[model samples]
Target: MSKTPAFNRRAFLGSAAALGATSVVMPSYAQQIDPYTGQPIVGATAGATPDAGAVQYDTHANQRHNISSFRAQDWRPYFDNLSNGAILCDLTSRAVHYWSEDETVYRLYPSSIPVSEDLTRTGRTEIIKKVEGPSWAPTPDMKKRNPEWPDFVGPGPDNPLGTHALWLSWQYYRIHGTHDTRKIGRKSSNGCIGLYNEHIKELFELSTVGTQVLLI
Candidate 1:
């Protein structure tokens, strides 16, 4: 008769531990959480934040920056219908959510929000205009605060509005792109919601002039 092999309990335990370690060794990005919601962020894209070393400390030295949440959202709680599609800007999350009218498309992007409550506005609005290579002009209030700022900046690298801009019904409010990639996922904008250039380009195409917008 063949000799029975002893059950190697220690070896079995060691193999189990190795398997557990392998399971836990997920990518760093996969383990990210939404700092605001305390929930695991799923399906977030690489564009949600700037690449490593992209964040500029010199420009925002004193500001407290928060990472944007990439968690997907449902539109029902915010909109009655997907009329012309809908866009939701969640200030607390520092993120923007978009849903197409026919429910065929949905996107979530990191955003730059107002630096302070006084500059922020919350309500329903609609995109009244869409401009590519949008020009930039300091609001009267903006000029009052930053006296040395240029009165106007045409569409270019220096333009704060970046490559595309979706003008909203409210004066001086827009959902636009920013050349300063560091601004995304941080509270750094004066009022407008800012997206990475690549992201806003996609969103600009996905949205139209009549797209509904809500900020909260």
Candidate 2:
């Protein structure tokens, strides 16, 4: 078996790949030095459109919907104003709100899917582990959704988990990176939250082992 490569925080920060700043819009206050790539990660202004050139993975996808139009009231109750390390994912808007210890609020796009008729059990969970360049394994349920899914895939740019993954306490759920950035801010994925590779890299640097996560 090929073991996942060791994650070296410092070495990753100084790596050459961390050079350029990304254009995704995270809260200005949430910007920080990427532990993976030493460059400062800056986000676009909230509500700004994703890069015009971002590829659309699904050729027959429906018309794109703007997250801003989604009602905030539907999920605001889940956000804890006093939390130092809590992540709130609004499945309706396909957005993730990360609250850091400094009280900084950053917005990230995550692909969402309507998993069940009743949304419970997903309300509160914590990150159990963090994996860098994680390998991919399709769950039985995932295979049922698409029988063509392979049993396994090695870690790399083409892997479904992209470059990093924050494993959630909730079984089989994760906040992770995606190979197709176009999936961000869209209704896709099985049930896990998906982030752009750069976004997840920044998130991986900021998140700890026990960060709280609320999905609504």
Candidate 3:
């Protein structure tokens, strides 16, 4: 940095002009906030609110930030696959986001749609295959604990597996139909992924026996 006279009026005017020009072309996708206070932020001169459709707090704790104030660009990251295209899971928010083969975004599902109450912190692999009249075999532990549940589970609208089950390849973790629709937007599951009954049914209708499923 070089020192200049504090009262350099010409220099100040030139710098202000450049800043004004830059702000005019700033993209909506960029997120900015006050460096000191965690409030909606823009440049020093004028405060700007975050763009709802663009910039979003990357994590529930706001540990990371993003910029998405302009255009129809997506701000979420995802995993790509040949059969499943790309998918994004916001674990903090419990939301599943899906995109097309071309990476054109499509749908967003609130987390409450499926919950895993018994979910442990350990991460593991799982398999998934669409099944009709899916039977939910309660673990011996679950049966011993939950005496209310029948010994042999059967498929129905109220079944825990609901109408469809995308059984996980990782043994027990499944993205399955939910009997409780009210819990869709919450972090309440028995360690298996859950989807709204209607949604799971739709996914079931769309998927074949060998349809590939991945958790991101």
Candidate 4:
């Protein structure tokens, strides 16, 4: 009979340690980078959408990520006064910064911006209307682009506008919640700014019509 090989305990333990280290490191790395793009995953929210052309994952992944810029900001640079309150939508950062009239409240939230520069509108605008359980109707241009899209979508899980909407002075423009939370921190909208459903609910309560808005 062949002599039994000596048990290589030291080698076995060394291999086991290395395997454990690999297990621990891989998931942390995976969480940081998007599987599809190999780019760092950035932002506070993520989810799916049913609306046509709503998920532009490839487009967003290819675009330069500005994760560092998504941060808190001062309200003074963009507004004369808090008034009802003030909202700053930073298109480049994909963030929404809010300030209460008395300076007691400040909120910074990740947001979704227009899909392209042509669809984007900068400068100042104001909240003209607020709606809860808001309904959605595709803009004529939206219908023209996707004739298969529904004529209307009532408030629910499928509504692209999510639970609330703060309509802006610019027609067809809104600071709203999106059922597609993944859109937050990405350029995925026709022209509106989108926040997570929960984030928008808090903003809706904290804000009022005439809240100053600036997109830059």
Candidate 5:
């Protein structure tokens, strides 16, 4: 007999394609940037909106979110920093944008939590590996153990890897999904990049197991 196709999280979050959002009333500290030069975009007054048309962002409000902090004069270090690799997000805008060299950049799916202080590491290296739906397996090194930890949910809605998972070049480092939808576009994860369920599904499907994940 035939078995069921693995459960896909993207299928469950179908609403993501039709999703909408409202803009956060950001603090004044978050705006200001050089347009021509990609530098430490200075902070701007709370009421001003700059770079109205150049910055590419995806927002829930369905209204334009100006990237007032970046100056057009600034220059991105250039993707040449690492060839055949993708920038997880565009720090030039200091916002979450993911795209390849030839593509237009857009806001990354929002993130759930801020960077946990626990994720302290001095340095990171680059490598390539295969990615698959994370099979929530408990490792011997886990500080704490969950006896009831789910194993191999077999690629369904409940899978934390969600719509997609990018197996990093290094071992155990992945860019995958989060059950936490509210938190995106911020620093959060256990040394891995997390994307919204829908967005990840798109990435996962577009990518393959050996796709290179660069974290320089």
Candidate 6:
């Protein structure tokens, strides 16, 4: 297993208290740009605290960070709807959860492509395909932004898709691995879900082509 971050509940609660309590919107999906990473992040929301068991820390940064301030409305409600596996991309928390015989959750920071608001899609979809060591092709829109961007990048360390990819039913979206570890817990993808290489490898091993993927 790759190095996983440590989770210390006592320390987290202490820091959270010091941070002060603030009221926020309900069913909060508010978005904002992160000052540190310059990537968009889901704004904090006002809701009941998540069960301690369901909470985990995203230890990519030196400071403490909670994976989710609110619980998934219905934990694993789509279990019966999946055959191969199921994945939840919690856009509100910048995290991912994989469901199989057993459940595994991961916190990620992904880069969001600067696109029109209409293009930011939200819904449930199926994993159309799965690939290992996948190549990347810049979209036409991406190329328009950077005329010099490479048309294709073969599987390698520099490949933006990293080592594994779970293609979604949505034509342009995917859940893939990332070579840049720093982007693991921020909003940084162009619609696709981004995970650390290790996390993706784990998911790839457990997931199959027909897996259900929820973008909530």
Best by TM-score: 4
Least lDDT summed over 10 consecutive residues: which range in candidate 4? Answer: 17-26
lDDT tens readout by residue for model 3, 1-216 = 999635332342244212311112222222243222445544331212111011111122232111221112243433335354433344454554444545443554443322232343333333346676677666665555445445555665435666777665566566666554433444444455555566566555554444444454
Candidate ranking under TM-score, highest first, comes to 4, 1, 2, 6, 3, 5
Kindly report which residue stretches of model 1 are placed more than 4 angstroms away from their true locations once superposed. Answer: 1-69
Give a tens-digit lDDT track for model 5, residues 1-216.
Answer: 999655333442453223322234332232232222334333221111111011112232123223353222211453333233343333222233344334443224433221333542223333244345554443332213223333334554445455556655555555667543423444433445566666666665544443333332
For each candidate, give its TM-score against the true structure: 0.70, 0.63, 0.53, 0.74, 0.49, 0.62
TM-score of 3: 0.53
Q: Candidate 2, after superposition: displacement of residue 12 in Å?
A: 24
**Top-lDDT candidate index:** 4
lDDT of 4 by residue, 69-185 (tens): 765688887888889999999888777888999999988776778777777889999999999998888778887875656788788766888898999998888888865444666
Candidate 4's displacement at residue 78, Å, is 1.1
Clashing pairs in 1: none
For residues 1-216, write the lDDT of model 1, one tens digit per residue: 999755342443244212311111122442254322345544422122221112111243343433323467899999999999999999887778899999999887767787667778999999999999988777777666656556667877656777999999998888988765555656666678988777789899999989999999
Q: Give a tens-digit lDDT track for model 2, residues 57-133.
A: 33343425453443223234665553447777776566566667666544443444333333223578888999997
In candidate 6, stretches whose alpha carbon ends up further than 4 angstroms from where it belongs are: 1-74, 77-80, 101-119
Model 6 Cα lDDT, one tens digit per residue, 60-143: 323222334423333446456445657777665555666664444332222222122343577789888889999888676656
TM-score of 5: 0.49
For candidate 1, what is the lDDT?
Answer: 0.68
lDDT of residue 25 for candidate 4: 13
> What is the C-alpha local distance difference test score of candidate 5?
0.38
RMSD of each: 14.4, 14.0, 17.6, 13.2, 16.9, 12.5
